[model samples]
Each structure stands twice: as C-alpha cells, then as structure tokens.
Target: MNRLRTLLFSILFYGLSVPIVLSVPVSALFGRAAVVRHAHVWALMHRMLYRRVMGIRVRVEGVVPPGTYFFAAKHQAMFETLELQLLLGGPAMVIKRELSKLPFWGWAAMQYGGIVADREASAGALRSMMREAKALKAEGRSILIYPEGTRVSPGEQPPLQSGFAGLYRALGMPVIPVALDTGIVWPKQGAKRPGVVTIRLGEVIPAGLPREHIEARVHAAINTLDRG
Candidate 1:
C-alpha cells in the first residue's frame, strides 16, 4: 500500500512539476513577486498532494517567531526544503553552488531569494555566504539553512558544517533551530511511510557566542527529535 501511494504521488508530482516549472518564465514577466508566488504555489501543491495521496502529515510543536530570522533546520529529506518556504513565507534559502548551477531551475532559484555558496569550509566561502545572507536580509526575507548541509537518516547526529557557524557569527543573525522527524517517512529509496512528521521550533539563540558554544547549542536543538 505504501509503495502504491508513493508511486502514485511520484507520477502526479512529475506531471504537475514539469509544466509548473515551464510556466516560470511567464511568471517572471510580472515581477519577482509573481515568481515568488509561483514558487509558493509549487510548494503548496507538494503539501496538498503529500497529505491527500500519501497520507503523510506534518505537525508543528512551537510558534515560529515573527520577523526575519536565520532558521537552522534538520535536513532529513527534501520535504522541509519546500514546506518551510510555505511555513516561513518565502525565506531566502541556502543552496549549494552545484544546485545553483543547474539549468532553468537554477536561474529561478535566484529570483526566489536563493543564497548560493560552496560547501567548503574556507574563509573565502564564509565571506561569500555572509555577503549573500546580508543582501537577503536587506530584502526583508529570513534565511533558512540546513546546517549539516545535506540530508541524513533519522537518528543520525552529525556535526554541522563550518559554514553555518561562520555565517551565523559574521552575519550576526539570531538563530531559530528547527527539529523535524521527516526522515522516518522520507528516508531510503523506497515508498514513503505514512506517519506524522513533527517539527519543533526551538528557543532562539542570539548571535555572538563563540563558535563552539553556538555550534553545540544548535546541534542539540535541531536534533531534538533524533532518537539516537
């Protein structure tokens, strides 16, 4: 049954996504606002279909504070990437240089406030990220980043990438660590399990802490749901 649902959802998703992406250029003519809304609708379709067809549900445990913030979230699957854009109202999301270098979708990512950077742990990369982040904040958009930099299996606890700590301190942005249990359902190359995915918005940690302390705090906070 789960496999059937996953197959059905995949079919419907590709059917919807291809045309939606193709329409983005037309959306661009109206302005950035239109493009962003176009992106939102794309995210919405994901949520709608995931719930109705896949029987997967999402539940939040805390209120997301108002105003612009740097949201550091767990990377369990592709689910949170788009869903958070809907939950956070189109924050500028961090993407790797590889993903940003993709074809049309890559160009569209920028229009919707993508901050592209290399995953390298170097001074130059950190400086580049801060530059992109400051520009996004100026646009009145929050920044959403997966500090570990990639998806991990549920219960796997990994140290954050160096870029997160450097970017947080240099940018001086407060952090809102988010924890979610999406991987239990979304993990592996198989059908997605039907279950509730819990997202917890942890207490805000202000900037200026030493890198070790900040990293420790965020590492623990974003893994609140990790059974390991």
Candidate 2:
C-alpha cells in the first residue's frame, strides 16, 4: 500500500511539475508574477500530494510569525519545504547550490526566487548567503534555513552545524525555532509511511541570545520532538 501510494504520488508530482517547468521560461518572458503565482499553486498542490501520498497530516503549533524573519527550521524530511512554501510569506529558501543545477527543478527554483548556497566554500559561501539573506529580508521575504543542513534519518539528529549560529549572529533578527517530526511519515529517502507529522512553532527567540545558546535551544527543541 505504501509503495502504491508512493508510485501514485510520484506520477502525479512529475506530471504536475512538468508543465510548471516548461512554463518557467515563458513566465520569465512574460512577468515575475507568473512565476510567483505558479509557484504558489505548486506549493498548494504539493501540500495535497503530501497528504495523499503519506497519509500524513501536518499540525502546526503557534503562529509562524508575521513579516520578514529568519526561519531557523529543523530538517527531517523534504516535506518541511513544501509546508514552508505554503505557510511562509514572501518565502526565500536557503537551499544547496547543487540543486540549482538540476534541469527543470532548478529553473523553477530560480524563477521562484529561491536562495542557493554552495556548501563547499566555507567563508565565501557564508558571506554570499548572508548577503543574499539580507537582501531578501529587505525585500520582505522570510528566510528559511535548516540548521541540520541535511535530512536527518529516523532516530537521529545530525550534529547541528555552527553555520546556523553564524547566520543568526550576522542577521541579528528573531529566529523562529521550528520543530517537526517529518520522518514519522515521510521517512527520508524511502517509501512513504502512514502517520502524522507534527510541526511545533516556538516563539521567536529574540536577538542577543548568544549564538551557541540559540543553537543549543534549537537543537534541544527539535530533539525533544524527535524523541517524543
């Protein structure tokens, strides 16, 4: 049953994404609004697909906050990104630069105003990300970064990278700690499982909290949810 759902979801997803990918260049030629509107629709479609594919429902806790702020969200599965797209206003995702090279998906990402960061160059990447983040924030776009950097498999929390702290320090804005158990249903890089994915949004951690302290708290919050 899980495999059937996964197959059905994959078919529907690719079928839907192909038209969007093809239209990206046309959208670019026409106007930026085309891309934004299409992307927003895609987000809604993905949300429906997520629910149908995994038989999982997302329950968000607390307000996601209004206006531009850095979203220090935890990464357990790709589902988080889909949810982020729908809920996060003026969304600008911080994604791996490599994903920007993919054919269709890359064009769509670029068109939709996603931020791509090269993970290889330590200093250069950080500076570039911060610069882009600041510009995006200035434009009223909320930034989303997964402190874990990559998907954490079930029952594990990869060592929280200091990049997040560095970003928080540089940005000096309220960091909203998002805790979600995506692996409960999404299962990183595997067949979808049936269950519920709970996303808890904690109050925005005010600026001036030491970087390490903020990182620790974010880690602890996600870990607490993962363990539960």
Candidate 3:
C-alpha cells in the first residue's frame, strides 16, 4: 500500500512538474519576479501533494526569523528542498553546478536566482560560491545551503564540508541552523512513510565567530532532530 502511494505521488509530482518546468521560458519572459513566483507555486504544490497523497506533514518547531541571513540546514531527503522553498519564501539556494547545466529546470533555477558551485573544485568552488553568495546578500535574500553537502540518512553525523565554513566566514551574516527528520518519512530512495517531519530552527549563531566555533555549532544544531 505504501509502495503504491509512493508510486502514485511520484507520478503526479513529476507529471505536474513537466508543464511547470516547460513554462520556465515563458515565465522568464515576464522577468525574475515571475520566475520566482512560479517557483514558489511549484514548491507549494509539492507540499500539498505530499500532505494529501503521502500523508506527510511538515511541522516547524522554532521560529524562522526574517531578514537576509544564511540558512544552514540538514540534508536528509529531497523533501526539505521543497519544504524550505515554501518555508522561506523562495530563498536563494546553493546548488551543484551540474544541476545548473541541465535543460529547462537548470535554466529555471538560474532565472529564479540559485547559486551554483562545483563541489569537486574545492577552494575554487568556495571562491565562486562566496562571490555568488555576496550577490544574493546584496539583494537582501536569505541563502540556503546544506553544510553536509549531500543527503544523509537519519542518525548519521557527517562533518560539514570545509566549504561551509569558508562561506560562513566570508558571507559575514548570522546563520540559522535548521534541523529536521525528513528522512524518517521521506527517505532518499524508498516508499514515503506517513508521519510528521519536524524542522527545528536553532538559535542564530551571530557573525564573526571563529571558524571552529561556527562549524561546531552548526554541525550540532543541524543534527538535533536526528534520533540516536
């Protein structure tokens, strides 16, 4: 039954995404605001589909303060990607360069103001990321990044990628560490389970902290939702 539900939801999700993705070019004709508005609508649709079809509810435990701050979140499942878009009102995301190279979706992401960085490039990637991040900051938009770099199953504690610390120090903004257990209900590769996914926002870690201190705080804060 769960498998059937997952399959049905996946079909509807992607089926709907096709027209939305195709409309990216048309959306761009109207300008960036149009593109962003379309993206937000897409995220909201995914949230509705997840709730109605899969019975997965997303609950926020802590306050998500307003303003142009950095959002460091746990990467446990694809669910958070959509959830954050709705949660933060279309904050700019730091995504892989490869994703930006795709067809329609890639172009739409760029048009919608996503920052793409090459993870394999190490220091060079951080430099590129910092430059793009600064631009987003100038626009008064929040920056969303997964410090661990990739999705990890719940209960796993992977050290944050070095680039995260670099970006944090260079960006010079408060960091809001978001912890979540989305993997419990929405595993990376499996049937979606029906449950409440809690997203807890930790206290803001102010700017100018030492690299070690900031990294430590973010690492711990983002894992608070993981069950032992």
Candidate 2 stretches with Cα past 4 Å from truth are 29-34
Clashes of each: 0, 0, 0
Clashing pairs in 1: none
RMSD versus native structure for model 1: 1.3
lDDT of 2 by residue, 1-228 (tens): 899898899899889978867877777776655677777777788888878675778887878756567777778777788777776664778888889889778867877777767767489888987887777667667778888888887678776676777778877788777888887777767688777777888777887787678878888776768752
lDDT for each residue of candidate 3 in 24-87, tens digit (9 for 90 to 100) = 8888999877888898888888988999999988789888777778899998988888889878
Better of 1 and 2 by lDDT: 1
lDDT of 2 at 205: 80
| TM-score of each prediction | 0.95, 0.90, 0.96
Query: Which candidate would rank higher by TM-score, 1 or 3?
Result: 3
- Superposition TM-score, candidate 2 onto the true structure: 0.90
Mark the regions of model 1 whose C-alpha exceeds 4 Å error after superposition: none
Per-residue lDDT tens digits of candidate 1, residues 1-228?
Answer: 998999999999889998888888998999877888999999999999999999989998888777778899999888898898888778888898898888888988888888877866577877877898898888787899999988899888888998888778767888999999898888757789799989899998997999999999999999989964
User: Among these predicted structures, which one has the highest TM-score?
Assistant: 3
RMSD of each: 1.3, 2.0, 1.2
